[model samples]
Target chain A: MAELLVYLAATLVGVAFLLALYRFFKGPSSADRVVAFDVLTIVSVTAIALVALAEGRGIYLDVALIYALLSFLGVIVVARYLERGL
Target chain B: MDIVGGLLLVGGAAFLLFGGLGLVRMPDVFNRIQAGTKATTLGTLLGLAGIACLQPDWALKLFLIGLFILFTNPISSQVLARAAHRSGARKSALTAVDRLEEDHGA
Candidate 1:
């Protein structure tokens, strides 16, 4: 049951990732692409969590944590650049 | 317990999918950020909760992850919106308010 759930969630998130990728590429403005990128990272973190459960591994949770932090930093830096400031 | 966890996982994934749909469909950057941040944050919390349920021993760490998400999602979205506005991304024509503009001349 748990495995089935993990698979289902991962599949759904994969679909979400595709949609986000489309927006990232098709967005009219830089901000639009940045927002799409942010959504993609969030979806990836969720994916990591689901995969960790499916594989019965604890180490992947740490990966999720680090990924989340780095994504936050990336978004902030891009936003700052968009604002034409440091 | 497993069944409950599975349900949470499915529901969270559904929310996540909706967020992505909103990102594609929303008319403007602000609306897109609104949809993306709210839906994804809730979805992520639910997904983390489901994992906690499935792995009782990892509950504390999962909780911390969820907490981090809750705090950061809104902050990032807010900063993005502010930067978008500062960079002159126009709002949708249908938008009702310009208070932020009137107040700060943004």
Candidate 2:
């Protein structure tokens, strides 16, 4: 049952990634694209967690942690640049 | 335990799906930011919790990740919203107010 749910969760996350990608491509402005990018990174983190669960490995969790940190920093830097605050 | 963990995983993924939907469907930058930030934050946290439940030994690391996301997601979103406003990202035509503009004098 847990294995089945892992697959289901992966499918959902994949759909979420595609939706975010559409927004990234079609967004009317830079801010909208940034928002889409932010969502994409978050979804990816969830995907990584799901992968770790499926693989039954603790190491993948470290990758999720680092990815989340870097993504947050990247978004912040881009936002600051947009506002000319950087 | 497996059933409970699976349910949480599915629930979290569903929230993420909604967040993505909101990102695409929202009419303007601020609305998209609102949807993307709040929903993803919750979804990521819940998904991490589900993982922790599924793998007991990894619980500490998962909790750390969740805590980090909870702290960073809102801060990043707030910065993005302020930047969008300052950079003159167009607001939706149906937007009823301009509180940020009034307050920031931008």
Candidate 3:
């Protein structure tokens, strides 16, 4: 049952990734792309967590945390540059 | 327990899908960020919680991951919105006011 749930969640997140990719490439403004990228990273972290659950591993949780931190930094840096504040 | 965890996982994924939809369909950068941030934050948290339920021993790390996400997601979105506004990203026609502009002028 849990395995089935994992597969379902994976499918949903995969669809979300595709939609986010479209926005990332097609957004009119750089900010829109950045927002799409941010959504993508969040979805990725969720995927990583799901993987951890399915594999019964704890290290992947650490990977998710690091990914979250890195993405946050990336967005902040890009945002600062956009505002000419960096 | 498995059933509840599964429900949470599915619900999170659904929210994530809506967030992506909002990103693609929202009228302006700010609206897109708002929708994406709120929905994805909740979705990621739900996913993490579900993972915690599936693995009782790893709950502490999962909790920390969720906490970090909850704290950072809004801050990043706020930065993005501020940057977009300052960089002159176009606003939707339906936008009512420009508080930032007024503040800058004052």
Candidate 4:
């Protein structure tokens, strides 16, 4: 059951990633692309968590943490740049 | 416990899928921000919770990730929205309010 669920979740997340990628490419404005990128990163973090579970490794969780932090900072920086020409 | 965790994981993934759909289907930048931010935040948190359940010993780290996400996601989204608005991202004709515009006196 766990195995089946893991595969199901992975498939769903993969589809979500594709959708975000589409928006990232097709977005009419930079802000829309940024929003799509944000969603992409969040979905990636969830995928990382799923990977950790599938592999039974605790170390991947730490990687997920750092990825989340960096992505948050990246988004903030980009947003600031957009707002104030920084 | 495994079944419960798996269920949660699937549920979270489902939410993420919807968020992605909304990101693609929303008519404008602000609406995309709303859909992407809110749904992904909840989905990520729930995914972390599911992982925590699956690995009881790693609950602490999972909780930390979840907490960080809860705080930062909204802040980032708000900043993005403000930036978008300030940079003149076009709004859909369906939008009926302009409170931020009024506040900015622009």
Candidate 5:
């Protein structure tokens, strides 16, 4: 059952990644692409968590945390540049 | 608790799917972000909680991940909205009400 859940999560997140890629490439504006990219980062973190669950490992949680922080900072930095015209 | 956790997971995934659908079908950028953020945040949290249900040892870390996501998703959305505003992406004409920009100009 756990294995099933893990695989399901992986598949879902993988599809999410694909959708995000479409947005990244087809975004009408820079903000659109950045937002899509941020979401892709989130989806990737979730995908890693699912992988950890499948493997029954605990270390991936830490990786998720770090990814969250890095994506947060990246999105903020990019938004700042776009907003302030810097 | 197992059943409840499973339910939460299902519900979360439903909302997540709805958000993604909204992203694809929404008329404009701001609407897409609004739809995407709320749904995905809740969806991901519930899904993570479901996984935590299976692994009691990882529950704390799961909560931490969820907390970080809750904090960041809205913050990032705000940043995106700011960028959109600066770039002059108009809200959908159907929105009918928005106070932030009104306050901004006042």
Candidate 6:
């Protein structure tokens, strides 16, 4: 039953990731693209965490944390670059 | 592990799907941020809580992720919004209620 929940979560999040990717590719404005990127990051982290559960491993939590940090860094970098006056 | 957790997991997934759909359908960047932050935050909280419910021993780690996400998601959204404003991403065609452009008008 637990594994079933994990699989369901993963599938739904995978679909969400696909949607984020669609927005990332189709967004007309730079800010739109940036938001899409941020959504993608969040989805990816969620996916990793779900995978961790299915695997019954604690290590994937560390991976999810790392992913979270990296995504934050990516947002900061992209935000700074797009700020135009920086 | 139990039905409660499963419900949370399913609910979270549904919230995520909504966020993604909203992102594509929203009118502007600001609207996008609003949808993205609220849905993702709730979805993530539900997802992590479900997992924590299953593994009682590692609840600490799961809770940590949830807390970290709660702390950071809003902060990053604020940063992004500020950057967008300071970078002049707003449209001149927008209504006059924008606080970010109040003093910058010609």
Sequence-dependent TM-score of model 2: 0.96
Candidate 1 ranges beyond 4 A from true positions: none
| Minimal lDDT window, size 10, model 6 chain B | B91-100
Which residue pairs in candidate 2 collide? none
For residues A1-86, could you state the per-residue lDDT of candidate 5 as single tens digits? Answer: 54554555566666666776777787888887887777777766666777777787899889988998999999999998887765
Instruction: List interface RMSDs for the candidates, in order.
Output: 0.9, 0.7, 0.9, 0.7, 2.2, 1.5
- Residue-level lDDT of model 4, residues A1-86, one tens digit each, is 98798799899999999999999999778999899999999999999988888899999999999999999999999999998887
lDDT of 2 by residue, B32-83 (tens): 9998988898988888878777888988999999999999999999999999
* lDDT (tens digit, per residue) of candidate 2 on A12-86: 989989999999999889989899999999999999888888787889989999999999999999999999966
Question: Local distance difference test, per candidate?
Answer: 0.91, 0.89, 0.90, 0.91, 0.76, 0.81
Model 3 C-alpha lDDT per residue in residues B1-106, reported as the tens digit of each score: 8878887888899899999989888999999999899999999989878777777788888889899999999999999998999889999999999888888841
Point out the higher-scoring one by DockQ: 1 or 6. Answer: 1
Q: What is the DockQ of each candidate?
A: 0.83, 0.89, 0.87, 0.90, 0.47, 0.68
Candidate 4 per-residue lDDT over residues B44-103, each given as its tens digit: 888788888889999999999989999999999999998999998999999999998988
Instruction: Please identify model 2 stretches exceeding 4 Å from their true place.
Output: none
Report how closely model 6 matches the true complex, as a DockQ value: 0.68
Determine the iRMS, in angstroms, of model 3. Answer: 0.9
TM-score of each: 0.96, 0.96, 0.95, 0.97, 0.86, 0.90
Most accurate candidate by DockQ: 4
Candidate 3 regions exceeding 4 Å error are none
Cα lDDT of model 3 by residue, A14-53, tens digit: 9988999999999889999999999999999999988887
State the displacement of the C-alpha of residue A82, model 2, in Å, after optimal TM-score superposition: 0.5
User: How does residue B76 of candidate 1 score in lDDT?
Assistant: 95
lDDT by residue (tens digit), candidate 1, B1-106:
9878877888899899999999999999999999999999999999888888888888898888899989999999999999999898979999998888898888
Chain A, model 3: TM: 0.92
Q: Of the candidates shown, which would achieve the greatest TM-score relative to the real structure? A: 4
CA shift at B62, candidate 2, in angstroms? 0.4
Better of 4 and 6 by lDDT: 4
